[model samples]
Target: MPKSKKRAKAAPASKAAAAQTGLSRRSVLGGGAIGSALVLGGGFWGISSFRTYAAEHDLSRVGDGTLAVVQIHDPQCPTCTALQKQTRRALRALDGCGLTYLVADIKTPEGAAFARRFNAPHVTLLLFDGQGGLHRRVQGLQQAAALEEVFSAHKAALT
Candidate 1:
């Protein structure tokens, strides 16, 4: 019968040298995974943060001679929240349409006064032309497609 030979273990010095090279399989793979996760998480966080920041514009700037879509929003209103989401989706469809989005948050004095100026309530969308003219006022929740069509037409008419 032939005797089988045992595999030789790597020396501790060689192991240290291998780690110092910084190209070992375990180090490469582990570092790559952690790096990838950090990049992905950072991108996601940045996008979400930007969206949240852009969602709320200065209410006082609504009629600042810019074509804008202002939403009379009450945070407690479910319909208002739904309309806000729908508006965002609609804007995506109308990208480059040159319409600034603003929120008339009813919780603030300025927002409340602005809403009262137009006698608009929560869940209302007030479309203003470039000269701050109230071109259209839509109440209640609307579909993204409809909002897109309306926004596109308004954009075309003004420009």
Candidate 2:
């Protein structure tokens, strides 16, 4: 009786199969760790860049005897558009209040940095007093009545 040669051929085939798979335990783990490190590093770099940009730009526009309504938003955002409409309605209602409205596009690097510096969320509304002090901060979508109330409360400073 002849012993089968199949078992002898199987050993080399198994080694070839392992080579085709190409990845070892160490390589996969190491690659994953390196990839994660790169992602984290990139995130930190982005944050640093935003901070630097914010520091370079002058965000304080309201000066003595002037009132400012700063709206930080993304033009493409539906919520921001809605907020703009609501803000316009509010401003119309308070026609006599000598307030200035400034729209900052968050898509720009400067805008992004400004929002971060002020800790404002997307579609944020910031009210500044004549002295350039932040009087109120509103985050997210706001109703016309709510915005009007804020303006009304700051009317004395605005005029």
Alpha carbon lDDT of each predicted model: 0.86, 0.80
Q: Compared with the true structure, what per-residue lDDT tens digits does model 2 show for residues 27-50?
A: 889999999999999999999988
Q: Best candidate, TM-score-wise? A: 1
- Residue by residue across 3-97, what tens digits does model 1's lDDT show? 32222234566678787896687887999999999999999999998876656657656667778999999989999999999999999888867
TM-score of each: 0.67, 0.58
Q: Where is model 1 poorest over a 10-residue stretch in terms of lDDT?
A: 1-10
Name every residue pair that clashes in candidate 1: none
Quote the positional error of residue 130 for candidate 1 in Å: 1.7
Backbone clashes in each candidate structure, one number apiece? 0, 0
Off by over 4 Å in 1: 1-55
Q: Worst lDDT window (10 residues) for model 2?
A: 53-62
